[model samples]
Target: MEKVRQATDSTVEMPPATGRWKLIGPGIVAAATGVGAGDLVATLIAGSRFGYALLWAAVIGCIVKIALAEGSARYHLATGSTMLDGWRSLGRWTSWYFGTYIILWGFVYGATAMSATALPLAALFPILPLWAWAMISGLACALFVALNRYEMFENVMKFFIGLMFVIVAGVALLVGPNLGEAVQGLIPSIPEGSAIYTLGLIGGVGGTITMASYGYWVNAKGWRNPAWMGIMRLDNRVAYVVTGIFVIAMLIIGAELLYTAQIALSSGDRGLLDLDAVLEQRFGPFVSKLFLVGFFATSVSSILGVWHGVSLLFADFVRNHIKGETGISREGLETTPAFRFYLFWLTIPPMILLYFGRPFLLVIIYGALGAFFMPFLAITLIWLLNSSRVPAQWRSGWLSNGLLAIAALLFIVLCINEVIGLLG
Candidate 1:
């Protein structure tokens, strides 16, 4: 295999052709990271309010994410640059924007992710207070990621994904989904007042910034050149296919069980707990407990995924911008002080927020930043993949461009709506 010199002053050897399907770690990590408790609640809400009405939205959401992830991976493999590196090449302003957004985003999201992970553990045990569980969850994930290297982290994520799939899919089956209605859901139609829900389902199926982290994860998995492109595509497909199934299963449960019962869940992560109560009442304690365990898996996996993946991004940002590093080297990033600093940033300070609660202004800023990220990502991806930034063969084709454009428009509208809601 030929080796190419990357900006990081390292040689990237083209991976040998083998069973590409076997190289599937990063996609699983991204998939697990994307489907948090919030996604489950959103799908449940959609199903309960308009049974199978927004199912097409979920499918489309997976497709959109697949394109985004693929573009990110393609950029890294083609140019030997991280997403942060690509953004930096766009301009220093891009670097400043991302650097600022990620810091603020991480502060607020740490608390949010920790709390979400804590909820199910608290429900299952009833021994620890929510705050305590939240702290423990944060510390536990921090230690796990801090201790393990990429391979170990990937394996752990795979276990969580499998556990979540079996439990959630099992519950959906137990709920007895109406197959005919599910099939009909493939046709697009928005019931009255379902426009926002439909859009949210389409735009918010799996993740936000985590989509960008897909490249970092792929890099961490040692896939460095265009030779890995086919494997990367397969990995991405399998990831979202799992994501689609997990989401569809939740919608089925909501459509069959909650929609039929006319029971509406409360908003936020609490809504998942409400589903647990309903599940216990409808089935038994065992099923409800099983669902909560799956919920815990989903939330904790996000914590772990973000802790590992985004930390890599942060480390890369610091390397390219702060340290004046031109190339992205895996060993350099993994061992850098910046990586450890961001890992600590993700873990410790957020625990203080867990105790004191996120302040009002910080939450507002976080919400605003979070709202625009998907649009920012989409537009930048279109620019990066289509421009001379990437090689001709590696550049996005018309179909990829079309999907990404549609994704950009969808997210821009969603960003506008979110901003309006925040201001309102």
Candidate 2:
């Protein structure tokens, strides 16, 4: 009920990040978590369908996410509060929305992420069935997060991002991209009926709810004040730039390997598997296996990230709203009962979905609720950062405002389409 002032804490270290690249952690986590198998597959599909015609949209997508992630992280660094705290200050509606979302989304996504991650592992080693692999991988990821601290989790994510980079970039290069046509695509041309397709590429660039988790990761990494803002920006930018490049690489693969060859890939996580099979046929077993390894990294990264980050969010949500108790910092939410509970929620219960198909009603509800999360996050960030809830100097400038506004609009479009598809 009181407006807190001052952006920086005197006790926190304020060292310059001039030559300290290794000091960055949260951004890498955000990047790894954001660019999951779904994002990559979507990009690959775009490339396969339109070749390099939509390259500029992928680039712009990264820029949009950079703004959103940076805005979320900046709010934390500048105000010393989590996004949830800011959202709570807005209205009680924020609480209800997130409460429903984290529950349904986590339940459904647990099965989906496990299934996606398991697909490659199952393909690699046929000894186990997909459902068993899904449960094992999901539980294993939850265990790893529950056992380790953010420091260790971040290190593992770094490895995964690195693996993703090497594999996607390698495949892109191996396909020998056409520099000239790619340059032409940068000018932005509408390829007939590709409006919705192009929008999906832009909207699905990095991630959805994970962007809201950026601040928690920021706090988890000891960036609890505005002093860390400079390095945080640099870290956020570099991560999404790498994300952009990674998507671009996938696009190139789709263009050269799939588009030119007149190959079609399925949509969603299965699309990555389709790509892997295509790679095996076209490039050989080694290349296909390498892509599978990368696929494992991408999906696993998403699992670990959602397992940890969203748990922290749920913990905070429980702390302030459900429990009606406070005093726990956002950074400190990782150790809470609610945190571990959500982690378990993400791991075990979803295994049932892996066996019995998701209930049609449940799936529809999940889709309808999950669709608005990004729009909710973007709009809320815009509200919080532009209000007096943040320090005067640290509030969003016109450029930041513009980007957040654009992100909110774009996500709303995506939300509408998804909801109509689900309910219609």
TM-score, every prediction: 0.96, 0.97
Candidate 1 collision pairs: 7-327, 8-327
Off by over 4 Å in 1: 1-16, 328-330
Model 2 weakest 10-residue run by lDDT: 1-10
Backbone clashes under 3 angstroms, per model:
2, 0
- Model 1 over residues 291-313: C-alpha lDDT tens digits? 99999999999999999888888
Candidate 2 to truth, TM: 0.97
lDDT of 2 by residue, 1-424 (tens): 6353444557776756477587777887887797788888888888888999999999888989999999999988888877777777777888888899899999999999999999999999999999889989988998999899989999999999899899999999998999999999898887987888788888886767888889888877877888788889989999988888898999999999899988888877888888888889989999999999999998999999889888888998898778755434444677788999999999999888998979999999999998888888888888888888888889999999999899889889988999888878
Scored by lDDT, model 2 comes in at 0.86
RMSD of each: 2.7, 1.5
Worst 10 residues of 1 by lDDT: 1-10
For model 1, what is the alpha-carbon lDDT of residue 421? 90
